[model samples]
Target chain A: MGVRIQMPLSLRERIGMEEMVEVEGDTVGRCLEDLTRKWPELKGELLDPNGRLLLRWTIYLNGRPPSSSEELEQYVSEGDIITLLPLVDGG
Target chain B: MEREIPGGYNGRILRVDLSRERIDQVDLDASLCRRLLGGAGFIAYFLLKELPQGTDPFGPENKLVFASGPLTGIPLGGCARHTVGAKSPLTGGIAKSEAGESWGPQLKRAGFDALIVEGRAHRPVYLWIHDGDAEIRDASSLWGKETRETQEKIREEVGEARASLAMIGPGGENLVRYACIMHGCFDAAGRGGLGAVMGSKNLKAVAVRGDRMPPLKDPQAVKRMAAWLKDHMDLVKAFSDYGTGSPMPRFEQVGNLPVRNFRDGGFPQVERITPQTIKGTIRVGMKGCFACPVQCKKEVEFREPYHVDRIYGGPEYETLAALGSACGIDDLKAISKGSERCNAYSIDTISTGMSIAFAMECFENGLLTLEDTGGLELRFGNAEAMLEMIERIARREGLGALLAEGTVRAAQRIGKGTEAYAMHVKGQELPMHEPRLSKALGLGYMVNPHGADHMDSMIDLFFSAFTAQPTVAVPDLIPLGMEPAPLDDIGPRKVALFKAFQAKRIVADSLVLCHFLPYSFSQVAEITSAVTGWETTPMEQIRVSERILTLCRLFNLREGITDEADRLPERFFYPTQDGPLAHRSLSPDEMERAKRYYYRLLGWDDRGVPTPERLEELGISELEG
Candidate 1:
């Protein structure tokens, strides 16, 4: 099933101008991988050299932020909304 | 004013009396410096001692103190921070707003640690300081000028291109309750309407130019810290690249960015006005404060619907959310223009936007109409109307006059049960962040003396123990006992953490350091000891913070702010209507408990007043005198 992937204004330049993109996968990680597969230019921005999700972003699955980046492999069902958000420490 | 001092300070305090047109210089005692350090700490000491109980905030008797910390003027990233403090005209309580730019460093180099301004001038004037010399100059020509124009005229009159100015604009001259004291074209001590205080005194601005450098006690250690900061550039590069608005997406995702005057959770047009989009569209360059590596200020230029000037500066995250999402406007160009207008008028963007949002909501509810708006349609998503309202507020024309008084006063003036819709805490409008999404922030809004200030304490989401999901740990906070707790729980652990972090924030503001800078508690303590030679530690720093907070609370209590006043708006009690956080609201009982627990933690009595024993422990028993 397809999940809706949303990007912030800051990421749209690198990931294209679209606010939300649709991708098919079973888990959060798989959907993200599929997202990168379609937009290869965004792979480095989302993941580090070691294939770990960058801590600079808080990947929210259906409006719920993961407790840790390790949970990126959590199951993602159809119609889920995935939002990529930057982590800001201070104003 | 020159005197020999230890490594960190210049050892001078400049005092100005507008009524007498007098200027006095006094040597700052070493004992005082050791006890209070500087910046907000010094402000708290002076305000508690010099100001009597129930002093009018805008009257001639009230005093405004401009202070800088020991680390200010040092060659380090985020070192150029300074603080402007006084009895808040908005909250009628103690208030301090910090600004980072060249002005603080210039003041330090001019041989002054602080400037205390009192009395009211018979005519418009500006205070000028250069080297160790100071004077009161006529500013009749600058009385009604915009902030940028006033800065230009002051610099030209002083004949120093490098001279820095802290000035008010038309908003201050007109006495807008939320007018801000602006520096250069962008940086501002933006809260509590201290600029209106400046207006009440007939003081237009303070300009300083200097070339002297203070001797450091441990230059090598300072250099090492600077090097450490440079090496850790990655910690703040994102801020420099995106300014503060880069995190808009994250805030929106969690329903932190209040849309349509807090009626909605998230904005559908967030992407159009985010930092990335603004950068790609109208951003020309990035700007930095004094000795700062993190250039977290955007320089934007737009020549479309409106001729947005880059000289007025671009919007920060709060500005974006306030003028953009909060108003239901997505046009980046319009938001940029609104930001420039606010800067030109020297009004606080948060209060200005939130005021407009309040008005727009009233309009939607049929409390106001186009006839009431002076023939302008005051509705959500009307970018043109919003832009017009900004200019009108600056000029104080018709409807603008009421709105310029700020949301609290405006709501009172329009009393048809409109107070419920006025989003304020202690008379000051809330910042862009919605407290429902972050409960700790809600607590902060309730307890902050300055009113709804997000920077006063730790935000909930940033807590080390935010959630059970692999939490991101900040090793630096471990010493202060900050760990992740449930994001929404106001449990004892969470309350304890909140109290601890609240102390830390006071320390940061007193030090006058940018909160964005990655300075650990230990690092801050080490740096303080190295710079001031007082042999400080994290524990001592926290103690000093508690003293400052207690003194401020005393000042507020003197202003009649009691337990009944220490509450949030009714809007915060009800569940959010829509967003990722829909149906989430703070428990009134738990909030009351947290407030009581926090008061107890700080050694204050049940009514939130510091006990005599606690005052003795804080070395401020004499304050009761």
Candidate 2:
């Protein structure tokens, strides 16, 4: 079973121009790890040096975000959807 | 023979006394240019020097200054910017706003670094400036016209098909306190009621056309920088592709988007009104300002439901949130139509949307009635009512008349508990940003001279997380010694960071650079040096920016806007009903401490007044009123 990861257009060019990709994992962190492993360049964009998700970018499991940082380790299921979005300052 | 001016300057300041129907030109002072640079700096200096204390904002004594910086018209990515300043009718303080397009560059090409207008005109008129001369022409026939027709008629009368113009609409003519001066079709000096000042002068437009470009000291260096920015298009591809509203969903996720008049925590229909949705639906094309490759401006056209003119341009993130989720209206077309109306009528979208939202909240809470709204159901999510209210406000009719006074005054006149719903600071309505999400930004909303402006400081979210081992998304800020901090931190460290970022933003405004561009402070200094042949550095620019800010503060203080007015509305002190920030709230004591700390950091006293020694150190002690 696999989860679908959606990327914003701003980072698409860095990840071979794909808008969404599917990866297999049991956890949100594992899914991101697999996705970043496939596109090594995205590792820096999605994670900080401590391997935590960058605060500037928010990860949503389905339509809502994870409640806290530890929620990254929360279990996922088949057909779960994850989305990445950047929190820019102004217009 | 003309006197020698420095490189990147035409060395002329055009002065016009509309009451006397006189026009004259003064030589730009090189020393003043060195000290203040231009744009916001020049505006601050002139307003502080010439404006008498307690001058009525709409009176003939109020002066309007339009200024361009040393970098203006330099054919760079974000150099086509300028500032307009006057005593604000809304906030009753120093009003300074910036706009970018071809107008500032055109003014530079027309052989003037700045244009100052004073006194009221006896009749309707417009200024026609071309090449190296300017003349006042009759605009009597163009009175009561909307912005598009006004621009077209002025261009035809001036006989310059491609001339750039800055003008106002019926909103200004009727003296709406928040009227904005629209530049070109879409770009606006869109805050602080500068347009009403122009209208008060009975001036309709200032149109300019010229072929001359300012001479740069190092054209090659400027070209190299421009090329470098173009080469780095990937850094701003999202903005280039989708414009500013592309991050609407993300803003909602982080509790940044103002929902349901800033009372609600979330909008389930946020995705329906974003720029991406507009691009897929009503957007016709994308455009950019002079010499800019980012092309963040959006163009939209539609004929169904309601016809939205492409000439008025499209709404950005502020407009989307202000007129959309803030009012609980997710219909993108209605919001687009509302944006068009604002651009056409020369009303400020932020204030106008916010005023309507305030009215909606009042109506929903039983503070206002159907009769009060002239038979319209002024409820949240009522798109038609929102649109109707915009027109009425522009015309100053019915409930629009009250809203046109802005929320603070409207709440006062309503005589109900509606004051709590008026989300404003120092009489100016808040922008679309929610302070509960970013605490430092909330502090900025309090202390900003013009009132609740989003662009006054760097947003806290940018500094909330590091993108790499040692830097945030804005790595340019690293040289300024800014380290990553949490979004909710408003400690001394955060206050210091805020001051540095505020100084940098003020420098950009004074330099008249675009905030959206990711230029480093060193890059900005290098460009300034290359253009003006001055040995500039990042620290020097920061000092100059600080000086400009202090001058603005002095102007505000002289006008009676003291430190007591530096506070957010009570709504911000409480948490939203639901959302990511539902459990979060701003403490008044903490914010008070942060403000005082910020003041002390800027060398100001506890009351937020600049010390005499600090003024002397900045070399502006004599200008103190």
Candidate 3:
């Protein structure tokens, strides 16, 4: 139920992330939480201090946004692609 | 500090009467510029006092005033933004303070504080100003030319290599309600149909080249402030290199953008049409206004050198948003093409794009068909279809005629439940900032005088990204008790203080300083002290800006949009359907609590009119006295 997560271009540059991060969690949110936990320094910039996700950019479960944060809890099948698209500002 | 000057201010207000074929220049009075800070401020005041009410927006009774602030010709931040004010053919208001650096610096260099244009012409004409000499010249040959061509022709005719020109294209000539005036082929006094005002007067362009620069107070101090701004290259680099279009990717990810007429927040192919797209396709150098260090403008040069990439001002965030996601066209090329079309026709790109998007939505809903659209299937993401509509609208041929009138009136004319789909505030198309995500921006838009503009108050952003208190404003009511709250963060007090601070900071841009630079307090103080030698502080400097705001507020009042107009659009109260803000809406009852508190903070009555005491205290519109 664990999958590899890829950091967004913006987040990668900010956190000096590797090509793909190894995360073990049942859901996308869980995976992200695990990723944040492993990359502790990346927490504030990616998630709000209260741990709520910053909505400024997009985080896709596979190729699109997951319906809910809880949707990440769904067991991740192998080869699922999670793309992080964090934009600094929206025009 | 009192230096005796010889002919510093070419203090003459030029008036062109096309119907009478007479041109006159009046002497500049100190009180005029003093009361209205010279640019949009002066124009707004003049329009309120001189132009008669109830006259048709297109009639000769209305006049157009193009002005630059005191810092225009100065070498400070290249902030020479001009103001164009008149009865809006689009919004039917007394003024829309639109500007571009080209018109302003040129006016100041031409040795004039401002240009006041009046009366409609019997035929086409353009104004030619060369170093204090201005005349109404025949523009019959350039009548049908686009903005760039007309400018080239005028420059050629005048035999001047470097001249700042303001011109309208086919859109304005056709009297499109949202027609804008273009300067430097990229910048525009874009909203409220000022170009149409110029067209109605039969004035095609205003070309100016001046030999002198305005005298600044305390040159040494000015230089120091300029140097401080110069050292902060990071801030300047943020805008200049990426241009404002850098936000496209973020907006897509955030779900704050309107993809296909507010139906969706993100575009499927948005990456293919962002600043990165341009970076990958062409070599673009940074561009800027005359005195601006932060050149958020882009100049892309194509190796093949097609007509499109020959080099022009880059489209900013608003243009990208309007022409891209708003219309469901994710192709950067088409968005750039639409921007080029706007420059050619001198129309507001935001309104034009929004109008077309609304039309497309209408088509999808079966309100418009191929027959109605001349056999074009107006579906979302059709770049060619978008191009066809823009060209047609600019030309005022076929369906273009109806769309040229702007989104609000067009929606009303079309009827069929399309009004709800037309995204506008107080009859003006909404600018970029999705208010649900950035509530402060939305509140700013709600209270903006030119109809729901975000620049009026943009603090919601700091709160969203930086501050601890997330959603704080009085939400529309004044003084639950007789006395207002303290100025601290206790309850509604912080909201009141924030509003006043925002108003002051924004209004200083009336002096034409780029808001990006953190130089307002120091340079504004130096300039004030140098000019009048008043011992000024940051707080006092803002009060001077507030004085100008008082006049603008009065103009809005005279234009018949009062405190009642200070409400946001209804759509914002309901949560959005796309993105993270889908379930969130700023409720009216909530807004009422905050706005009422704002009115009380400004010392206004329950109706939100500026109190007589407040007016006297702020020295509102002192010139009329």
Task: Give lDDT per model, in order.
Answer: 0.82, 0.86, 0.67
**Best candidate according to TM-score:** 2
Candidate 2, which segments miss by more than 4 Å at Cα? A1-31, A35-89, B1-5, B466-474
Judge candidate 3 against the unseen true structure and give its global Cα lDDT, from 0 to 1: 0.67
Q: Is candidate 1 or candidate 3 better by lDDT?
A: 1
TM-score of 2: 0.91
Compute the interface RMSD for candidate 3. 7.8
Best by DockQ: 2
Summarize candidate 3's per-residue lDDT along B1-625 as a digit string, tens digits. 2223212244667777778878787876665554445665676677767766566889988888887666665666746676777888877765565565567777878777778888887889888887878888889999989877887889989998688888899989989888988887887888888899988988899998887775665666667767877865543443555666554554565555667777665565667666656766753576677777877676655433224643446566788878888887877766777787788888888888888888898999998888889998888778788889888888887778888888778888889887877777667788767766654455566666577564455434333331232333221112221122321122365455456546544445555554555443455656545543345555554565566555656666666767777766566777665665666666677566666776676667777677788877866524332
Q: Rank the candidates by DockQ, best first.
A: 2, 3, 1
Compute the interface RMSD for each candidate structure.
10.3, 6.6, 7.8
Residue-wise C-alpha lDDT for candidate 2, range B373-457, written one tens digit per residue:
9999999999999999999999999999999999999999998789999999888899988888777888899999999899976
**lDDT of predicted model 1:** 0.82
What interface Cα RMSD is found for model 1? 10.3
Cα TM-score per model: 0.89, 0.91, 0.82
Stronger candidate by lDDT (2 vs 3)? 2
**Candidate 1 deviant stretches above 4 angstroms:** A1-86, B1-5, B464-474
Stronger candidate by TM-score (1 vs 3) = 1
